[model samples]
Target: MNGLKAGLAELEALIAAPVLGGCNLLVCPPATLAAAFAARAAGTHVQVGGQDCHWQPSGAHTGDIAAEMFADLGASHIIVGHSERRTDHGETDAIVKAKAEAVARAGLTPILCIGETLAEREAGEALVLIERQLAGSVPEGLAALVIAYEPVWAIGTGLTPTVAQVAEVHAAIRAVVGPGVKILYGGSVKPSNAAELLAVPHVDGALVGGASLKAADFLGIAAGAA
Candidate 1:
């Protein structure tokens, strides 16, 4: 939902000036800019992605973009079941699972997102809620995928959970999903706390949002991953 044509050049220059750390860098820009950004980031370690995709390969779905469409645009990954999608579009877990399967079928890694709201956390049902989402949204026997835990309340609010709290939830996700799946912590991730958050156990990386819109801030967060 962000980033303009001009912005892409600035970001590409920054990334090209110096290599990023070992962590994989991916950006899911608006669908309109997918191919352009993909071309812009080509020949670099950076990868381009899609914000979301339709479960179907192609149909008369009107405005909906298919998973294969994103794949054709040189996107290496696509995000599914983002909290905002669930909240705004009323997408159910079943829908997310179908979309993830589609993304995988399209030969792109699906970044499955799962998290709880503030009310659910306060009610002491955070773990229970996330566990249910994991079981429902994640497909069986899918060995390759990325999971991002973005608490609904924390996203874009400059709010973040404590390291222990983040570790606790991530550990829970790892417990249910088994090993091999990288779990990234989202929600207001910035340079200031990126290192500390990335250090948390089971916290494989970050699913940055707002901070990633800027080159310096995004690079700073990526530095923390190093």
Candidate 2:
């Protein structure tokens, strides 16, 4: 919903700059800009991705983009089960799993999102619920994948969990997904707290939101990954 061709030019230069900390960067722009951005990002460290995709390769599901379409657009990865989609579209873990499977079939990686709502966290069911979602949403035998832990309550709220809180959930996720999977911490992640949050055990990377819209902020966060 943000960024146009004009904005892409700025992003192109920033993303290509040397100060990006050598971290893996992926941009998931609106569908209209995916092809354009992917073309610009070629041969650079920045990879392009999609916000969402349908599980079925082709169907009458109008207004829904399929995994194959994302691959066709040169997207190396697609996000599934984001809290926004789960809450706004009523997507369940079963649906997320199917979408992940479709992404695998399309020869693209899937970044699966799993997190708890504020009420769930308050009720002390965060780990229990996240584990349930993991079991139901993650597909078996994916060559490459990423999992993002974004507490629904923290997203866009400018409120973040304590580092220990993030570590607790990440550790639980590690136990379930095993050692090889990469777990990301999302939810209001800004440069100020990026270093501390990234230092937490099992926190592989970030699933940045608003901060990613600005190259300086995004790079600052990447720099904190060290």
Candidate 3:
């Protein structure tokens, strides 16, 4: 919540500066902060998004936020199948696919995340793992979805896969997702490595972690995406 507020304030300042024109920004904050951020971002170039959403549009699921609620709050996008959600909540591919469908039904774009762990990569199973995740996690007619590849072992670990490795995984993911899907790289994406990572084949953008908390780093990564 605090970070969202801080980012909104920073965005206002950046917009006021005439030199910072021609940039697009999207902020995905916690559910509690979505409405507030959406209202604050109204009429601004900055767009608001939800960090996660429930698989069902409306249900008795305890402590789960639905995608419709996020859309009602004016969220334009929703992050699904994040590494944290998969690791901490034990979410599977089927669950993520349902969530993606819910997001689409709610009229929001779903950012579908897919990746492999260190063990899988070490065993030469990264492509295999990603293929399964892509096939099982994404629904048919995926034009409204965005795919983010976040290697589980790299997130918050201060470690990242090599440029060649990233390119290979992204290429494999793109092949499976077809030509329309935008494949983004995530996991410890820092300003220092953003340039190289963004240059990789099939890498459309990044789902940054700790580095995204700062305006400078996030903007640097965004700029690299261009």
Candidate 4:
């Protein structure tokens, strides 16, 4: 709840900033803040989204928000299978696949996240991990989905893979996802590294985190993407 409020406040400020006037920005806050942020983002370039959603539209789930609810609140996008959800909530690829289908059913785009942990990377199984995740997490029809490659070890660790490494993984993802889908890179992406990361082949944009919490940083990253 606190994070959602803080992120919405930050997004409000960023949208108001003159420097970020021309950038394409999307902020996926918690579902509770989706409506508020969408209202606040009106007349601005910033687009509001949801951090996650339940596959079922309306059901017996006690604490789950549905993608249709987010859509009703004006969310155009929703993220699924973020590393935090995968690790902290024990969400598997099959679950994420369901969520992605729900997002599509609700008429929203799903930004599906896929990545490998440090141990997996060290074992030289990063690509294998990504392939498995992709195969299981993504559905056959992917036109309504976006893929984000966020190395779990790099997220919030102030560490990132090299440009060559980023390019390699992104290319492999593209090959699997085919030419229609857009692939994004996420993992401690900031203005400092945004340009280089965006320059990598198949990297369409970013699913920023820490840097996204700040207006200057987020705008800088957006500019880098441009």
Candidate 5:
């Protein structure tokens, strides 16, 4: 939602970067740029995905984008249950679960996002809240499942959890979701902090935000992951 098509060139440079081993670089732009991004990323290590999608395959959903449409547009993944979607659209865990299933139905992967709000965190219920969201939002049988834990308080605020705090929640997520699933931390993940966050145990990767808009910053973070 923050970018215009002309700005695509900034991210297009990512396509030319050497494929870093052990790092799976991906860029999930707003729906409008998905196909164009996918076209540029074809045969490269970078994979393009959708920011969000609707649960229904097709119908009168008005402004809502469908999961199947993402796949048709060459998107390999679609992010479901983002905090913004939850807050702005009043999407519930059940709705997120349905959307995950919808992404799977479209033969695309689902990056199911779950997190706790500032109130929930200050109430000392962050873990509990996330666990509930995880239980309710994630569907079964999602192989190579990707779950992004983006604390609502930290997103785009330039505020991040301490390494120990991140470790604690990520470990908790691993305990419940098991070891096979990949869990990513998503709050304020800038190049400066990406290395530390990626180094955290149970922190499989990052669901980068603002920094991703810049090629240098995003690649620097990818270098850390690599």
Candidate 6:
């Protein structure tokens, strides 16, 4: 929702960054740019992905993009149940589960996003809600997956949780998802606080937003992960 075709230049900048080993930089552009992004990122550490994906492979679901379509375009991953989608589209855990399964079927990794709103957090229901969403949304036997925890209130609000709070939630998430699953933090992530957030326990990566529009800032955050 935030990019124009000019966004390709950002991807190009990332592609030109030094190939630091073990650092995976994935960009999920709007469906409209999937082909071009994927094609450009081919053979590079910069991988292309999808912001959202439909559960079904092909259907009459107008304006919906499918996981298979993304896979066909060389997208290695797809985000399911992002907070915005949950709020704006009313996507449920069941719908996210179906989409995860669809992503696995297409040989792509599913990045399942689970988070709580400000009210839910203040009510002390954040962990409970996240656990419930994980149980309901994750399909059995996923070969590869990623979890993104984005506090709904913090997204684009320039406000973030304390490092301790992030650690607590991520630790709990780690216990449920086990050691293999990579958990990411996604709430106004930028270079300024990237190192602190990435250093938090159980945080394997970032589900970056606004800052990613600029390659220098995005790369700086990636550098923090190194």
Tell me the tens digit of each residue's lDDT in model 1 across 34-129: 899888788788889999999999999999999999888788999999999999999999999999999999999999999999999999999999
- Superposed on all Cα atoms, the candidates' RMSDs to the truth, in angstroms, are 1.0, 1.2, 2.1, 1.8, 1.0, 0.9
Each model's lDDT comes to 0.91, 0.91, 0.84, 0.89, 0.89, 0.92
- Model 5, span 129-159: residue lDDT tens: 9889988998987775789999999998988
lDDT of 2 by residue, 151-218 (tens): 99999999999988999999999998999989999999999999999999999999999999888888
lDDT (tens digit, per residue) of candidate 4 on 1-226: 3365667668877878664434467888766777899898877778888999999999899889999999898889999999999999999999999999999999999999999999999999999999999999998866778999999999999999999899999999998988889899999899988988988989989999878777789888888866
**Which parts of model 5 have CA positions greater than 4 angstroms off?**
none
Q: Give the TM-score of candidate 1.
A: 0.97
Model 2 misplaced stretches (Cα beyond 4 Å): 19-22
lDDT score, candidate 1: 0.91
Pick out the ten consecutive residues of candidate 4 with the lowest summed lDDT: 15-24
For residue 191, model 2's alpha carbon misses the true position, in angstroms, by 0.9
Candidate 6 colliding pairs? none
What is the C-alpha lDDT profile of model 3 across 32-114, one tens digit per residue?
77888788878777788999988788879999899999999899999999988899999999999999999999999999998
User: Considering TM-score, which of the candidate structures 3 and 4 is the better prediction for this target?
Assistant: 4
- For candidate 5, what is the lDDT? 0.89
How do all models score by TM-score? 0.97, 0.97, 0.92, 0.94, 0.97, 0.98
What TM-score number comes out for model 3?
A: 0.92
Query: How accurate locally is residue 134 in candidate 6, as Cα lDDT from 0 to 100?
Result: 92
| Top-lDDT structure, candidate number | 6
lDDT of 6: 0.92
Sliding window of 10 residues with minimal summed lDDT for model 2: 13-22
**Which digits, one per residue and each the tens of the lDDT, describe model 6 over residues 57-102?**
9989999988999998899999999999999999999999999999
Whole-model lDDT for model 2 versus the true structure? 0.91
